[model samples]
Target chain A: MSELATLTLAEAREKLRAGETTARALTEACLAAIEGAAALNAFVRVDPERALAAADAADARRAAGEDGPVLGLPIGIKDVYCTEGLGTQSASRILEDFVPPYESTVTMKLREAGAVALGKCNMDEFAMGSTTEHSVYGATVSPWRRAGDTAPLTAGGSSGGSAAAVAADLCLAALGSDTGGSIRQPAAFTGTVGIKPTYGRCSRWGMVAYASSLDQAGPMTKTVRDAAILLGAIAGHDPKDSTSAPREVPDFEAALKGDMRGRRIGLPKEYGADLPDEIAALWDRGAEMLRDAGAEVVEISLPNTPHALPAYYIIATAEASSNLARYDGVRYGRRASLGQGDGIVDLYEKSRAEGFGREVQRRVMIGAYVLSAGYYDAYYLRAQKIRSLVRADFEAAFGQVDAILTPVTPSAAFPLGEMEGDPVKMYLQDVFSVTLNLAGLPGISVPVGLSGEGLPLGLQLIGRPWGEAELLDTAFALERAAGFGHKPESWWR
Target chain B: MSIDTDTARRIAGLARIRVEEADLPGLAGELSQILGWVEQLQAVDVSGVEPMTSVTPMALPMREDTVTSGDMRDKVMANAPDAREGFFAVPKVVE
Candidate 1:
């Protein structure tokens, strides 16, 4: 699979700055295409001797010339970040064998931008499901199928193994998170290019919290200039995550130049309601490919986009029942053993009823019955006042639009146990991505085509709150007018 | 607004979680169909709105009171499922 495992993390950082390759040969061709795709379970952990000892210390810091911006490349990360000694399990059987003795400030800014992690991918256990079938290291699949149907499908979820390890190339860009619409619905079910950004643009300390005010972390590439060079190597302002955004990380790959002319965009009209007519003709062919690239699309109105998926499932399960009330097994994770005369509240209810799972115990019992106490103002203060009217419908459509488009998922990848015994039909497949994580903003998605069972279908956009370099320069002019350049043929290799 | 199997065993004992008796009548029919589809947020009228705890309007920052890093009792008892001398053992809360 070594077509240098299909380049593009900005063409393997321009063939490792033209020495024509060798961060241990593009991390041993992405660890031999993540050891032959292992039927797209898409990496849980692969290390390869600490990713070829961080690709031989990024080829000795590119032969002592020391250049960065993802130097030796490789990348994959997202078992919800934390990486130090690795095992970081947000794919949770209550952090099965946890590990992490520190690191994750976006994998220490992708190991100080020399990259090469090549491990920990699978997600949706604590990031909680749209379909990595609420993983404990299980469902990833979607390398896209259909014509001559082989079944598998769903690779969209809490960053479905970083969108099936960057759509099966297994890794050239991965890191995910997006509290809801988990990394732009698995980069629109694996066609790739994800994003999220904006909610304090990046740094959520060590990442794993399901909804600390709607998690952020981004990039799941394949293109849009390798998600603006991995969002300028994992965004800025950290001082250890004081809600990150102290701002100033731009030069997102020098704000891609696909110039959207007189920009505007918008579209909304409550996401053209009950969609499906091939996602309302692919949201009118992504508003006629952003009005044939010169921009000005219009027809806006977020009309509280139908209360952004029940106020993002009540403020992301009331901040995931107060950030999973610190997994009570004591100092770390998985515990539940005592029994014969238990106490400490029956050892915090049998180690959280044997380390949570059924959709994180139905979102920590609907976030402890909407922050209990006579249903705290009738269900988490009316879902935080419908999350302030879904952030005043995207702050009044970013004051008549500078970016908004839509449709990231009204339908596409559905198959693996077809929305398994309905968890609100898998939370209505994140209704067009939980309103930009209930208006924290910046969106992305991209892919833009395919389906009549062929599959891909993306679009999204959104921007404005810290507008990720005008949302990757209008998703690089809708990825150069949806010239999508389809891929998915290796049927999971 | 339906959820009964004794309010799904009192919201799984106020979310400490451990619900059984046949998983509280199938977790009270899936929390009464996710609270009857989040009772469409009681049909909208958020009377004097305000409740958005945070979407990034910042504020909490502070910092300066010194002691920036912790000592790291063995990397905080390396993922302790039991630990002991340096705490985190759990269970016998004053037996």
Candidate 2:
């Protein structure tokens, strides 16, 4: 790896501002690192020409004495964002080679702030599976491994590639979308910092929809400060997204004071499942650290937490079924060849069957069943009502405490194919991360420590609705207390 | 709540995805297991709660009835699988 690739996003920004480094040099270092680490399968596409052009433009701006948060930084984008003239496939065959004519609002904002796009990272097909194995491009391997163990472990999905790239120092930071732990879970497994802001905090225009109500885009970076910086640049309301909130976007980096005096942190009793000993110990250690930071720690209850997974699955799949109905092989994407005398119905069926993967097909089928006339009340409506209960549980808890803390995942990263055969088991992986989405709350995952086998583990902090500033401040305190600075050796290279 | 082969086939048709006859049995098994797992939601009492259509409680914003941008037929058809004479080409429906 090049020496330039080792700098964090914040560090690189300082160097760029001080005239110690150029954006072209930094971009070239990341491109070299990406080329060397091909075995990790982190990036789906890397457009070096476009990246260099943007970096040169940033260098020109810097020479002209102009500066911004990400003035000369090269960052990776998840394939789910619609970048103009770039293939935004979402790692699915259905949208293969389908370049967009417009840019997503989030990416456009990043560009306007002078951030250069490195390339598109891989993800699960339609962001459906917990493991990125469901992608047409295949699974992304985590950079960390057990001591003396050659087995390739999974970088958790559906933002697995984003996490892997950051962990391996391919980019300063990357964009990741969460719809039931897609960002936090992967960040936890890869020992990176990921933040999923409140649901409507960032505009969703031009982003490929998975579960429209639950899906959200966030930042994945190597440190809490970098996550805060990226979040500041890519947040706010847009007229294009009707659901976006009309609220002022605060300077998130300024809120990372790292002081927790007089704050109230809650430990939800219901989150204590039959966790592994390492995870349980880590959770307790996290609470103790907060208490030592002069914050009052209290035990709270969210009684409806157990039903979040089932309800999340129902609502996500149902919405996914509705959102993905646009691809009919008529307007865009891959089309199945028709036999002689085939009708329109045959065209739709053959095209979808040929385009969608197995997991996607299963989700669509389940969605169709639940939303059908006979079973809508029993399944879909019931799930929505349960969703209300989940949100109510969080609202009730937040009234007593300022923020809630829990484990991001039940355990650390497991080997690839461990839970692939059982879809329900994979769904259970998002148990602790889904309720935040259901409540439209902001949450951040910070790497706290490592498991017994030497894999990374993370603790999740969930804040009240539209309370990201406070949430990031509290997370900064925890990050400073944890003081975790270990990096995995570059074995993938 | 078990999804038999018949129900699976019907669901596939509704979803407009062509499932092979040989894959129906496997698909039925997987769907049945998923439905069985989600049945645990029935144990919760959501009696008085209204079904949440969105996470935020705000109403959808309205827009003025005016054109924001001009037409770009070439840009709209840039990704079409088959386009001819500024229209998407599909199988003829009129006999």
Candidate 3:
């Protein structure tokens, strides 16, 4: 194994600061990793020249003794984020060559803090599906899978690329956006730790909007501490985004406490109910682990859990329909030819018909129907009502418990084509999630143990509004209990 | 209500997506199954429940009624299929 490949962001930064390793060496190691994993389809594009140039600048800054946690570290950014001079396609054919003039708030912060941008990672187009299968580019396979498994297992979507790249050690850590379970699900599937911080905790100013109400960006990393360090580099108030929270971002790396002595963790009754037997066993074992680590664990019910899926689909698809309306071919992406004398309406219809994918079209249609004049009362309004009930359920549960524990997905990663024809079944994979999106709460997925088939399972920790520290403590405590230290085989390396 | 092929085609058209006639039957079946899953929501009695937009119960923030936005005209129009004199030029709709 390569020396720089094994170093965490913390270790690599320390070495860079202490003159032990040059930023060029670290960037070169990451570039080699990316080149080695070319067959895995982790990155959409890699500009070696630009990345090295940035690294050289970081080395100069360090020589001047200026320091930041992420300075000189190479990070993979999801293509969904707008990075200047790099294509920000969101893995959709629509924006295949669209490069934004300005950088995303998160990207701006990363650059200012001195993290080298390795390249853009692939994702489900517009952050649509559960598996990365929906990407126009191609599916990103799980690095955790063994050889001869021709049918690659899912690296969870829409941030599956980000998680897979980090798991394969192609980049120190990657930025991922979670609209519903995008980040956490992919993190669980790949055996990496992912945090979807509290809504508005990180600015979504330039992340291509999936569902404006629910989309949040966070870090995917090999360990909890690495994720914290990356989060510290990115989290802060941005004047560009009105929704960006103004709360003080505590030093996330320093906040990692293995001691959970007085914390009360809730075991949501709904998560374990009717789940696959193997997944239930994992959830039970996770609760036991937390209990053994000197934490109080108790059963709590979020009775409105069953209603969360329906409410979320309605709210998310509704917002997505409105947000995606800007994607007519005349703006950005592919366009269908229109007759010279054709009117604006005809132009719009033709452009949209050619630009969007089938799944995106399905969502827009469903959303439009729900928000249409006659059905708004019956569909959209009713969904909003159920949304409040779902939020109230969390409030009630949090009154009794600090953080809720559950399985990230009802099951482990399934094969690529398993849920192809059934979009609803794929959406059901988000059941254990989505409610967090509706409530705009922070959630993290940490690897627990293996299932009966030896696939990895993850325990999800959800916190109250702005409750990331408590969530991380619970995750660290459980990570110790799980002892899931295995890495993916060399095919990925 | 079970959706048929006709309904599926109409919905696809309304959503501005082009679908072949042969694809309608499969879509109708898949969409109907989804509706069946969503129908589970109707069974719960939310007769007096207030619809929720966000998790917190706070009202919308009332900000000063001042106009503020970026002037990235060149950037915003960078991807336009056709542009003329710093504006998006579309085919004339009205005579």
Candidate 4:
């Protein structure tokens, strides 16, 4: 493996500034690493030409005295973000050959910050399932596997590809879109750091909408500082996104004071009730690590926690059904061939049926059912109220705690086909991380330890809305105390 | 409430995705199980809780009603599956 490919985004910026390495050298090293690790299937497409062109441009600008934060950084973009002239399918066959002429705000911001685009990462079709198995491109297996086990483990989803890419060193960092547990779960599974920023922190303009309200983009990287640096560059208010927060973007990297003295952290009693003993033990040890750093850890009550997943499915799927209605096959993407007497409605029906995969179709159906007449109040409205309670529960908890720490997932990465029997079985994986999206809070998953089987497990620290700076700081302290330094053996290649 | 194939067909129709008659039963079965799991939310006491319209508590910022962008007829129609006379072509709705 190229050592250049393994450098964190923060470390690479220093090397580039010292004239010790060129952007072209870093980009080419990542390209070489990507080519050598095809079995990972982390990237759906690798644009070496585009990557080289961008890197060369970055190098030129640096020589001209421009000092942007993310300048010369090589990153993988999730397929969910619309990268102009590059295929942005969101991993659905319906958009198999679809290429947007416009760019999503997040990617445009990354490019404007001088980041080089290595390629598009794979994800679940429409960001629906917990496993990436629902993708048209197939499952993105995690880089980590149980000791002595040869089975291919899932890297979690719908941000599975970005997590796998960062974990396997395919890029310095990658963009991940989180609606439910997409970013954090995958990061936990891969032992990389992923954060889902407070809702409205990142503009959704030009990104493929999953659940309009719940979906937000954040960074998945090898370390917390890299996450802070990359997140600062991409988040801000956008006139195009009406729901985007009209507030000041902070210097997130500077918040890494790394001192946990007197900071209050909450361990929600609702979490880990049903988790495996090892996961709960890892979480307990994480609390101990934080306690060792002088932070006051307390048992807090997020009383509405158990209802979060049910409410999330109802609300997110409802939004997804409405958002996905835009893909009617009249423009930009695959249009199923029709026969005589077929009208536009049939065209819409057939194209959608043929385009959406199993999980997506199921969610859309459930979404439509909930939103349909007679059930709207029985399902969607009640779920929205439950969502309000989920938020209120957090509001009450935040009254006493600066941040709440919980396990990122119910368990570590499971083997493929383990949850295929029932779709709800898969939905249960998001139980630990879904409530934050409902409450519109910022949450970061930092890998603190490994499961006994040897897969990485992460702890989540959720902060108040727009409180990512403090959240990242607490996570930084926890990370320092744990000093987790395990890497999966090179087995995929 | 368990959904029957008839209700599943109705949902697929509302969703605008075609489902075969044979597939409706399986789809209904899966949806029933999911909804059965989700039914737990119905027991929550939300009488005083309002429906959360947005995640963040920010007031929806309003902008003046004006066309900030336009005049890209070619760009607008570029991704159309079929275009006729600079417009998206579709099956005749009038019949």
For model 4, the stretches where C-alpha displacement exceeds 4 angstroms are none
Query: A1-493 in candidate 4: lDDT tens per residue?
Result: 6799999999999999999998999999999988887888899899899999999999999999987789999999999999999988999988878878899999999999899999999899988888888899888888888999889999999999999999999899999999998999999999999999999999999889999989999999999999999999999999999988888999999999888899999998989577789888988999999889989999999889999999999999999999999889897677889989999999999999999999999898889889988899999999999988899899999899999999999888999778886888899899998999998899999999988899898999999999999999998998888787788888876
Model-by-model DockQ, in order: 0.32, 0.85, 0.57, 0.85
RMSD of model 2, in Å? Answer: 0.9
Q: Give the clash count for each candidate.
A: 0, 0, 3, 0
RMSD of each: 20.4, 0.9, 1.9, 1.0
- Give the C-alpha miss distance for residue A430 in model 1, angstroms: 12
Kindly list the per-residue Cα lDDT of model 3 for residues A1-493, writing each as its tens digit. 4679657798898898778998889999999989989767888789999999999999999988889999989999998899897888888877867888889999999999888999999888899988988887888887766334655788888898998898888988999999999999999988889999998889898889988888999999888888888888889877677778777998777777777788899988877678888888888898889889888999999998988998788888888888888887676666778887877767777777666767777788777667777778877888888888888889899999888999999888888888887788889889988999988899999998876666677989999898887788778888888888767776754
DockQ of 1: 0.32
Q: What docking class should model 2 receive?
A: high
Which residue pairs collide in model 4, if any?
A: none
On lDDT, the stronger of 3 and 4 is 4
Residue-wise lDDT of candidate 4 within B24-91, one digit each (tens)?
89988999999999988878898888999878877788889999989988877777778889888888
